[model samples]
Target: MKFTDGFWLSRPGLTPRYAVEVDDIRVDERAGTMTVYASTTRIEHRGDTLNRALLTVTYSAPAEGVIRVRVQHHSGAVPVVPAFALAADPGFGPGIHVDDEQGILDAGGLSVRVHRTGGWQVDFERDGAPVTHSLARSVAHISGGEGTWMHEQLALGPGERIYGLGERFGALIKNGQTVDSWNADGGTSSEQSYKSIPFYLSSRGYGVLVDSPDHVSFEVGSEVNTRVQFSVPGETLDYHVIAGPTPKDVLRRYTGLTGRPARVPAWSFGLWLTTSFTASYDEGSVTEFIDGMAARDLPLSVFHFDCFWMREYQWTDFEWDPRTFPDPEGQLARLHDRGLRVSAWINPYIAQRSRLFDEARERGYLLRRTDGGVWQWDLWQAGMGIVDFTNPEAAEWYVAHLERLMAQGVDTFKTDFGERIPHEGVVWHDGSDPARMHNYYPFLYNEAVFRALERRYGVGEAVVFARSATVGSQQFPVHWGGDSDSTYLSMAESLRGGLSLALSGFGYWSHDIGGFEGTPDAGLFKRWLAFGLLSSHSRLHGSSSLRVPWAFDEEAVDITRQFTRLKMRLMPYLLGAAEQAHAEGIPMMRPMVLEFPDDRSGFDADAQYMLGDALLVAPVLSADGAVEYYLPEGEWTSLLDGSVQEGRRWVVESHDYDSIPARVRPGTVLPWGAVDDRPEYDWADGVTLRCFQLPDGYDAETTVPGADGTATAFRVRREGARIIASSSDARAAWSLQAGSATATADGAGTLTITIEDNR
Candidate 1:
């Protein structure tokens, strides 16, 4: 996608037509749009414009603090399908003005101004302060070897860092990297990604989203040292610029346009034990694993059956392998009786060897080629034909099978393998462009299943362990990191991907507890156990190997039990964060920069993240149990050991298997649940408000969500030396704890506690 060889030279066979100056600026009052027709070459004379190309640039306001820019070389080409589903307000009227010298379109606090007669340039400002701009020679159309592309480069401020190109496994900061917005099945160690969202957040309190499901390549300070360049094939390139005075504000506006993640179930946040992929598992082994956790005092919530649950090579048949589990219904009932939810693995493909494939092919529910033949591939499964989720009848047919599984006691699904969609020689049932549907297919596939789950289980109760995603796919609740090795390097890389995805507006994310590809060492497994259980969702899974705690060692089992119980106790705080994600777009597991935007030292801290708004979790990534992390300006109290650490500096801590850097932020009234056995219960019942280092005159309100979506508010304030806590809905028991002192309240009352050892 790079067209320039260096600073002043163009690559061979490349014809670059750069926008020189604006010739005409047209304002559409009703549409809230400003269209600028720019001559690709300088038009000094009237005859010079006769044969020159004119690039059309249009800017429109979609929502408050959001502006969409569309650049086109030829306007006659048909618009592409499978575009992002943007939520634009129709009645929003932007302030627009055009003059002979300059034109401006203001959308809320963000405005874009065009230089009418000067060298083609558009400056974007946040409340009259310059943020970025499309500078000279930054917009161009390049044609080479019968293919044309349109690209736009935006200026990057000094020390500005970019993040979130969708679950990236490389460095957390995206500076000096070339990223392509194409989904792939690449593992955690590679540059390719399973979820490639065409959006990036800046440390400078702004974000950009390229509006294309097709292949969009981005050169973040890579192609040009001072600009971020994005290009797409064919005539048009559309993108959105979101303004934010803070990273949280940027995500709020961005997710408002695409979609916010839904609220997942409470049990989904608990410890999940999965039958590892390609491992030897049946009713006996499964029962043994479930019973083993209980025997070891490990509080488990969900049990997942991986791909081998179905017959070999018959992925979408949705049938439990009779030879392995002749009674899936009764088996699932036994797990439910043990207080566990069930998740089954499924994909959007039908192997030809299965009976469902012929049925789907006959019913025209499979993707077809232009030659009128069914599209088949031998990648994951032999002769596997993808289910055409675009067709209404086809989606219904697919969901019918999922519904049947639901009837058999399946509570959720792990929607996998949507990244390998074929874009060549395939025809979509909805007549969408195949190239555009490549990345977008996952959205439709997961949507069909998620909507069905919601129909059956009700809203805020459905969950999916989906692996692939694109624009607007955050509406589906839970997604996990795909294939990863059982090494500390892969563990660190997976954290980078999850942190990146969290910044991309995803609320809930999970990964394999002990990695996915191979068996992890005891140290690695025990270390990852703390990290995984502390996530929004936790799952223990692997490939061809059991991820049971005993698979590593006895210490692993003890560590797993300890973290599982700890996570159960932290449900009240985590559930409140989930509710916030549903109401706004902020993620539960937040990057350091998102939580502390003013702390420049924490901008590049990816290994550690803020779990909800109170706790900071720094996972131990080394076998030696040594971890380095940065804390912003505050007094951080370790939730694990109750130790104190002063803020505003980097700290290295060595932890045992049962501990990590799980610290509570200063000035936080964290709601702690009394129960430590299960995730679902009366969350406000016996809740303890743990007040951490309350400075004088500090007051805040904290809310804890019930299992059934009910929320209760608790008011905490510090007056002199006493910390007082009061509840709004005190139908159940509550308490307040400051250091060693504790005070209790039965119902509709207030409790006060005094701290003796806050230091």
Candidate 2:
């Protein structure tokens, strides 16, 4: 994607056309836009523009402090489906100031100046200070042997760092990296990513998101040290620049433009066990594992059936394997009787021998080649044809099979493998451009299944364990990191991927507890058990080996039981955090920079993360259980024990398999539940308000989620010698820890307790 040889030379074969002089400018008051026509050759006189091509640049204000720019070489190419959602317009438009030498368009707090006499310079500013700009020869329409491309480059300020180009595992900071926005099946050790989002946030208080589903290549300080260049292989390049006084504001506005994350069900917050992929399993084996967990006092919530649940080579048929899973309905009923949900794995490809293949071929539900034959490949399965989600009947036909599984009592699905879509000489049913649908295929595929689930279950009860996603796919509830190996290194890499995805606006994320490729030893399994239970969603899965706790060691089973019960106890605090994420577009698990933006070290800290803006979780990554973490200036208390650690410095410590680094922030009123055996219960019935060490005049509030999907809220504040708790609902009970307190309540459901303050 890089075209320039150096600072002053172009590549040998590529021809570039630069917009030199503005020939004309038109303003559309009705559309709230400005259009400029610029010629490739400079026009010193009227005769100088005799024979040349002209480029068109259009600008509009999408929202307050946000500008959308579209550059076009040909004006006739209209994309079928744009990736991100469009912004809603306010009543008033921006202010425009034009002069002979320049023109300025002011939208809220952001301003862009278009030079009329310079070669090709556009400067962006905030309050009359330069933020970033495109200099001479920075905007070019490029052409090579294969096709044409539209390219744009913007200057990067000193000390500015880039973050969030999707679920990347290489480095948290994206400077000096060449990234392509294309989904792939690459594992955690490579540069390829399963979820490739065309958005990035800079530390310089701005964010840029390209509104294209075609392959976008970003050279972030790689080709040019002082510039970030992005190019797409097409006639038009459309993107938006979002301004922010803070990073959280930029994320909120960006997610508002795309879509906010949805709230998943409460039972999904507990520990989930899965039948290992590629391992042979029958009803007996599954029942034995479920019974073993119950016998050992491990709290289980969801049980997942992997790919082998269906017959081999017939992925999309949606029929359970008769030989292995002959009694799926009865088995699912038995599981539901035990208060556990069920999940099954599915993909978008149908094999040649599947029973529905001939019917789909006749009904035109499969993608066709240029010669009007069904496109087939043998990559993952023998002669597999991809279902065309762009077609309405095709999506309906695919969802009908899922409906059959729901009838059999399957609660959810693991929507996997939408990253390997085809684009070479293929045709879509809706006549959409195939090049663009390659990266956007997962959005359509996942949306079809998600809508089907929502139709069957009610609004807040639908959820999916999806693997691949694109721009607006956050509307679906949960996604997991794909294909990690069994090692300490892979565990850390998975955490890096989850942190990166959370920064990219995903609310809930999970990964395989003991990795996905091989069997983990007892040490790795116990360490991963603690980390997995602390995640937004927890699952135990592997590729060719069993992931049961007892398969490793006795201590592994104890660790699993211990952390699973701990997570069940922490559901009130976690569920309230999920509601905050759904409402504000922030994530439940946040990077250190998102919490403390002023600290420079926070920008680079990826080894630890903040869970729900209150507790800091640092997973043990070393085989010897060594961990080092940093905390901001505050009074910190351990949630595991009553031990306290001072803030504003780094501390190195070692832990056993029974514990992790979970610390609550100062002045936090954390909520806990009395029920420790199940994730689904009436949380407000016996809620315990575990108040951490609080300063005077400190106030905090949280919501308690119930088993029937209703929420009750409470507020607490500390005043000198007593803490006051107020709630309209009287279902909550208190367990005061910050003080030795005796409770006294008024008739209006308000209770005041005297603090012992033994510390």
lDDT, each prediction: 0.91, 0.85
Per-residue alpha-carbon lDDT of model 2 for 1-759, expressed as tens digits?
Answer: 799898787788888988877877778878888787878887778787777778998888878788888999998866566355655566658777777888777878777888887678888787777778877777889987788999889888988888887899878888899999999999988899999999888777778888898899999999899888899987889988887756777788788888888888888898889999988789999999999999988889999999999888887789889898889999999999999999999999999989989999999999999999999999998888989998899999999999999999999999999998888989999887787888889889999998899999977789999889888888887999999999999998899888888878788999999999988999999999989998889999999999999999999999998999999888888888888778878888888877777777667778888988899999999999899999888878888986889888887889999989999988788888878888877777767777777788978766777666676777888899778777776655544445434453322276767776622
- Give the CA lDDT, 0 to 100, for residue 539 in model 1: 96
Q: What is every candidate's alpha-carbon RMSD to the true fold?
A: 1.0, 2.1
The candidate scoring highest on TM-score is 1
Q: Per-residue CA lDDT of candidate 1, range 1-759, in tens?
A: 688999788899988899999999998987789999999888889999998889999999999899899999998987779888999988787899898889999999899999987798899999989889999889999898879999999999999999999999999999999999999999999999889999999998899999999999999999899999999999998999999989999999999999999988788888889999999999999999998999989998999999999999787799889999999999999888889999999999999998899999999999999998899989889999999998999999999999999999999999998998989998998899999999999999999999999999998789999999998999997999999999999999999999999989898899998899988888889999999999999999999999999978999988988888888889899888887788799999999999999999999998999999889999999989889999899899999778999999999999888899999999888889989989988989999988888899988888877765577888889888888888868578898888888899997788877666553
TM-score of each: 0.99, 0.96
Model 2 misplacement above 4 A: 21-24, 39-41, 90-92, 117-119, 127-130, 706-710, 739-748, 753-759
Work out candidate 1's RMSD over C-alphas.
1.0
Clashing pairs in 1: none
